[model samples]
Target: MQALKHFRIDFVITAAVLVVAFLYDSWAGVGLTAILIVVEIVFSFDNAAVNAKYLDRLNHFWQTMFLTVGVIVAVFGMRLVFPFVIVCLSGSISPWSALNLALEKGDPHTPGTYGYILTEAHPAIAAFGGMFLLLLFLDFMFDEDREISWLTWIEKPLKKLGKLDVLSVIIAGIFLLVASETLVHETHVHTAVQMRSIVLFSGLLGIILYLAVSGLSTMMEEREAAKDHEFEEADAHSSTGQKVLLAGKAAFSMFIFLEVLDATFSFDGVIGAFAITPDPIIIMLGLGVGAMYVRSMTIFLVRNGTLAEYRFLENGAHWAIGALAVMLVISIRYDLGEFVIGGVGIAFILAAWASSILANKRDAVAEGATDSTEQGANV
Candidate 1:
């Protein structure tokens, strides 16, 4: 019952959307809307865990922004305007024309339809999102400061390799070149030369964007750490204004990072939604509701300290992210269904949860045995 309180708003929004959907297309509309909501939630479950990890570091004001302003951006900006922008760019049309085409809800199989244009744009989308997410995963895997190891065999070697500076960037560059040369040939939307150019340019942009945002975040974090150290050394607290300024800077960078991460996660969900239904409104209602729930879940996890409770949960989410990054790149050439993508992440989360339980039990038993031996010695 206590847990349900966090999701109360999500439920209300879901009901409202369902009512609108039913009014629009009767029972059929209601059914499709339900399916989409589930799809979005299942696909983004690990995303909430990942978001919570960063969200935990933010101040209260920024955390509220994530739920309020962030929700508006995710629901409308990404779900509606972002797709229109993509169509306009890919189809060489105006925003109005893109909206008109979307309203027409033409068959995706038909070449000139909005859906067709979006589908054709998949290669570049995959390249950009794949590279961004790949770097994220690589950085996590290679972090020398990471104290915990979920997969010892894999993470141990990667942590050792982290001593070599910029290794992740070099590896990502190799992947981009390989993907450009090999995967570009699989697409029929553009000529090999054009496809190669698009993939290389988009992938590079993704890499550059990741580096820029992450660099800013690291700088802000270091500054904040320095300020804390200074205050501690002086045995004094900083003024409220100075603290707020530093917190604001750190929060702003993290907010940008979170939004970009959301966009990368959304690429597949938005594209995959068309496979289920062509109606833009329906897709928005379904995904919008799901996005709200994901945000709520992040807050719940942060407030409840779920990540701290389940020690391996964050590790599992990152592992799942690494898998998704690989899949996004492979999806440039092959159409792996949404189920395959979402299922892989869910599997990792479940496995990690179970492992955490076992670890707790083992530790408890070990402590019990030690206590018994100590008591006997004392006696």
Candidate 2:
């Protein structure tokens, strides 16, 4: 009963979203959104599990931010807008027309449109993916305690700044400004510019809201902790309220961060899909739906302790992230099919899961043998 109550909001919201989607079902709009949701869900299975570890730590306010603000940005920013950004950067087609062509013809770079003007796999896109991959590779190699020579001068200072809530806001705002300006500049058509601005602004808004909520949640947790001076335990403290708030913030932060990751992952899929079909609406529907399902699956994985039970899963996901990052960089220079990236990621995760299951069985068998030996000796 208690668990059901706790999940009531999520259930209701999901239902509501589905209902709206159903009611609005045009062959192009709502119907497409539904299918896309499934696709996003499948692609994001590992992502949700990774996010769950963090979600379980956030507070109520932060949790709300995850569902509301986080979803808005992720669904729009990456799933809907990213394809057009690719088109703009390619320089042959207007963003709006590119999107339209994608929807109508089911291809972003069809034979007739300006999409024909430039080659597939623009250089800039690859650079973006490469930069992201480089970060992941370095993070994996160095671990948290490792230091980078290039960042030595600023690393400590940045670490300190990260601890400051206010600084996060400033940093997010700056990033938003840059992304927005870049999107606007890349877009050739007036309508495309407007649409790009809206999408970019929404993303910026999400980042700002996330930082603000996280800061407030942190403050509340600190205040509550101070109130319970003697409260200490190895597993959990007596500050239930504080824990909830903290958990919510952590969950929200994780959700937002994961959404960013999903966006990064989707770059190749969304852009490459344009080659098959140009309609922005269809592309958006397919990708958006897929993204949502992945988010849900991630939450389910976290709640179920899937990753903890299968340590190899984390390694698989991180590896996928690294690979996708590299793929993005390659996308900038040459054409690699979206199917290849998605397929590689799925295969890696499946293999990791299998390995973990086998390892668990082996460990269980060993433990049983030890227990039997101990019992025989005692008898």
Ten consecutive residues with minimal summed lDDT in candidate 2? 146-155
- Residue lDDT tens for model 1, 51-115: 99899988888888999999999999888878788899999999889989999999987898988
**Candidate 2 per-residue lDDT over residues 6-30, each given as its tens digit:** 4565556555556665565544455
Runs in model 1 deviating more than 4 A are: 186-189, 233-246
User: Per-prediction TM-score, please?
Assistant: 0.95, 0.62
Q: Would you list the C-alpha lDDT of every candidate in the order shown?
A: 0.88, 0.54
- Candidate 1 lDDT for residue 69: 92
Evaluated at residue 249, the lDDT of candidate 1 is 80
Candidate maximizing TM-score: 1
